[model samples]
Target: MTGGAMDVLPAAPAAAAAEPEADEEADPPAAAALTLSPADSPPAPQVSEPRAPDSSRMQMPPGNPLLLSLTLQELLARDAVQVELIPEKKGLFLKHVEYEVSSQRFKSCVYRRYNDFVVFHEMLLQKFPYRMVPALPPKRMLGADREFIEARRRALKRFINLVARHPPFSEDVVLKLFLSFSGPDVQNKLKESAQCVGDEFMNCKLAARAKDFLPADIQTQFAISRELIRNIYNSFHKLRDRAERMVSRAIDNAADLLVFGKELSALGSDTTPLPSWATLNSSTWGSLKQALKGLSVEFALLADKAAQQGKQEENDVVEKLNLFLDLLQSYKDLCERHEKGVLHKHQRALHKYSLMKRQMTSAAAQNREPECVEQLESRIVEENVIQTMELRNYFSLYCLHQETQLVHVYLPLTSHILRAFVSSQIQGHKEMSKVWNDLQPKLQCLFAGPHGAPSPPRSPQDGLSPH
Candidate 1:
């Protein structure tokens, strides 16, 4: 048996086993090739490929870094800023809550009181002459009212967010510094910086050029819109004033009517003897007077309430319209400023190019100073490129900022005012209907006695029927 094991196996069986092993190794490569081959492989389960990202969703491109360091998205990022109110208890003389404005970018917290926000809002308005700074919440004389403070805290947060989102206002170095720094030192620094920026912006040649960028048609539109808003505001204000006066008069008239009704009642009760018809007439007149007084009093009360409500609504509409007008004006001013800067630069480039072209033409004509002509041509090309870029930027800024303001602020505010006005009219109609409904039974009862007949014709002696 050992000798037989040592002997070699049959060649055919050994060859057959070796061939199977080789075929197995080759199967892996064959399978891989088949998997890669489209014709041999089964249809790939249709996968819904992810759609390409929409370029429109991308944030505004960073244009001239010197002009703006942050995109609107970055500036308006919800997580970039946090405002918290920290309550502190001091000795009996000093207990206060501090408004902390924390900037994620600067990793700094600015501690301020409510008064500081008021000052900051004022400063913002003064510093950025054409920008619409958000209004601060009204100040409360009673400090440390928890609900009031909490409400104020929310408003302040929105106020800060609005300021930060405004491009020109947000880019102001002083504003950013104020938000990032604490203490009086920073305040003084910010004030000085703010004055410098304001002065520079106002006095610069750019400001002068801004008006040229706005077309005459656009200016006309703005003027027309402003006038319309002003007229509307004035009309509403007048209406409110008239309503208040009417309410006052109605209340006074109601009091006088009430007194007259009482006097008639007393006269009717007098027991002095009189003719039967005369007594009937006296009683009828007294009853009629009392009914008239009751109806007058009811109507006067309703009128007073309606007038008061109308006046309040009118006041609100007037105030809202006024605020909208102010915002519109601010938006116009900001657009003008931005356009001036861009247009001034564009015009400068154009002027430079023209001057260089003239110089190049003169040099070429002289046939003496080809090199100078070449230099002038190069400079002209540079100027042209700059001019083109500036023109593009001007259009982009106008469309992006001004158009957005019209859509977001102007249209929405106008629509809200119109809707409110319509609603007020509808409510007035409803209230008038209610008053008529309420007075219907009383009016019907005024003419009829308990038996629904003229109080039995008084002995038919008098020519006048009780009816």
Candidate 2:
């Protein structure tokens, strides 16, 4: 391409020289006017299409085979001229067009056209920043706002389609993009998604209400319902903010209840002692205290059995409740730490988002009105930041309840279970020890005689084993 490029010069006079002779001896008027005809044209041969330009127009350096090959290939190829301009590195003409490659050498261009542009782009990005290189003269900035709008609309549609394919993305981002565009089609799609989320939120609210009828001691079931309600409430806000008006009011109302209810019903403490009014009666308390002491002399044989069984039940319930409370506290601490992180990220995102909103508002009211392309583009970026912040907020609450492991459900439920066990132990002991110590001896004597001999035991199969 290089060797052949040198033979062609931009100053070559063939085009001019061929014109006059070709026009001579023509009819008087035609000849005087400098028009040429078929017979008088050059003999190299002519077809309907224009001939390739003379090689002299293309300039090239000597002895570069690669460049030569490129030039020769271009000569034989038809259609689509190639132009290359290589700028100098770290020099006065760094950004100027130093190497001009025309159609004559383009057919054998080394890089694929698209890849070629990228290569140049990367070079420009690196070099143009640090060097005082010459740059092309400026022209008008972004003419034809409508053309750009059409282009942006297509681009945004494609982007939304791509994002929809990913599960993790929040729909709030999608709707914000649509709202910013204010295009009918985009708005319709956003509205549809909002409706779906709105429905889910409503269903969660209904389920939560139903759970309120359950007994207070059944804490786990209620906790599950409440957590569900809270999740839906968070989703409702995110969707509502994005313009999901169909169910917006409903979701908003539900959210109000869920949020405020949680705040109002918030546990004073993760733990509490047994209620004071639940204390045992005086007679039962007396027996309980005696049981606590060594009862070997009065009820000698049954002393260890009663004490061990009663103490075991008390120890089991206390141990389980303590473990549950400890876990609840740990989870709360972790949630607080996470909330701090969310708050920090939210601050940064909101700052950027507000700046974008201000820019858009200013741009919208201008005399010419900023192009929809730029407005939508800026909104796309800003909306991303907003949605990210919102998601962070949702995640903070999600962690707050430790919903991933269902701890909110587990903690309260464990408390209820412990209460039931404690009540059962107190009631059972009261029933079994109601008789006085002397009454037991009287009963035994009535059955046989106070001095009567004991009855012989039956075969082992006649009685149940303790275990």
Candidate 3:
């Protein structure tokens, strides 16, 4: 019944019965022939052309899709960012550490100092006011020991990776410049790039209209998710500290084992060779003395094994835990930013607008000056800036909800991290079991019979009576 293209669809004889017979035409001689409309009008254009019939009208789509179909979750899953940080010596005395960054995102390697990272962090804060740009690690610690240096490097690497891997930040010009630019004036360059904060509405299409775009329960979902994540962060932060202490204890145990064996060797080497505790009867005491002398060597090997285990735990468990903590910590930072940064500015804008409204109203009522009132009216733009502030507030909330959802999406990483932890534990325990096995034969040799021949292994059945 519709006019334009459906009329030409009638030309297809196979499907013509689906359409009502046209008023303008009688039955034609052959059913396969084309049909035309009434005499008053020319035949409708072949609007429903056959496949491969035409090539002239091929064209690109009109514009970007009206809806936001791009998802942060899918983008994160598909895109990969590989970044490596190798800290090198810097400053005249070689007292400073500068990171040599090799970035897959840039396909380039650049040398950046702590100052460079600081500048870049400042720029990111300005550029993406609503995004969760994690805070940078402290610039310096009380003592710049090897542990501190390595920890600092890891923190900086993690922070950068978090920023780079984020979908919105991946396209940022500020990020691109900081990563790829190797100029002497990198500081100035970063400042110029992020000189002004961006307009929130321009960045988020439905920022001003979030009521229509976002879900009805999105606000409640955000609050619940944030609180859950916060609780997780608090619990896991303590857990991370406990994990660090566990690793430290392992390292300390390794060191203590080394010292313990050495101390035993020193005691055995004392000039007072046969103390009362030795219970030497002069005949068999020589063999016992010899065993004591070589005991340090056996124990030293065990200590070395302990040290290796400590290293394994550090890499596999503690590092993975730290990686997850970094993500949680960044979300924590984003939540704080929502309150202190965006909301604070929005409130200030409102306060300023109110003050201006009062000033303008009072000036007009008192008839203080026509020029003054006109100036106030022009600058105020009839509550124009307030409208922008309102939009930005809504936009900030929109981004906050989206970022919270992003955090939830990444929650599955905990499983992978835990799997790695269990594997490392298995490997570490197996290695220590091997060390114990090596010690068993050495113990038998130390207590060997008179000719220094090693004692044969004793079975558990030999110790029990079988009746």
Give each model a TM-score.
Answer: 0.41, 0.24, 0.70
Candidate 2 — worst ten consecutive residues by lDDT sum?
9-18
Candidate 1 regions exceeding 4 Å error are: 1-190, 193-280, 315-325, 334-341, 360-415, 449-467
lDDT ranking from best to worst? 3, 1, 2
Better of 1 and 3 by TM-score: 3
lDDT per residue for candidate 3 within 1-467, as digits (tens), equals 11221211111011011123252123222211111123211222211211322222222223321122334345445333433445555557556677777677478677888888899988777757766677777877445787777778878777777787776677767778878898888889988865443433354444446544444444445445644765676677786787778778777887887888788777556555566766545445555555566778867877777777777777766765776678766666665566555456656655665565567678889978666677756654534554554555555666665565555555656676577667766776787688778766656645576665766767779889676
Error of 2 at 128 (Å): 45
Residue 365 lDDT in candidate 1: 92
lDDT of 2: 0.33
In angstroms, give how far residue 150 of model 1 lies from its true place: 27
Give the alpha carbon lDDT tens digit for every residue of 128-148 in model 2: 111111111121223525444
Query: Model 3, residue 29: displacement in angstroms?
Result: 79
Stretches off by above 4 angstroms in model 3 are: 1-94, 141-143, 195-208, 264-283, 292-298, 344-382, 448-467
In terms of TM-score, how similar is model 2 to the real structure? Answer: 0.24
lDDT of 1 by residue, 273-331 (tens): 66776875666666666566566555554555566545655444544554444343444
Model 1: weakest 10-residue lDDT segment is 9-18
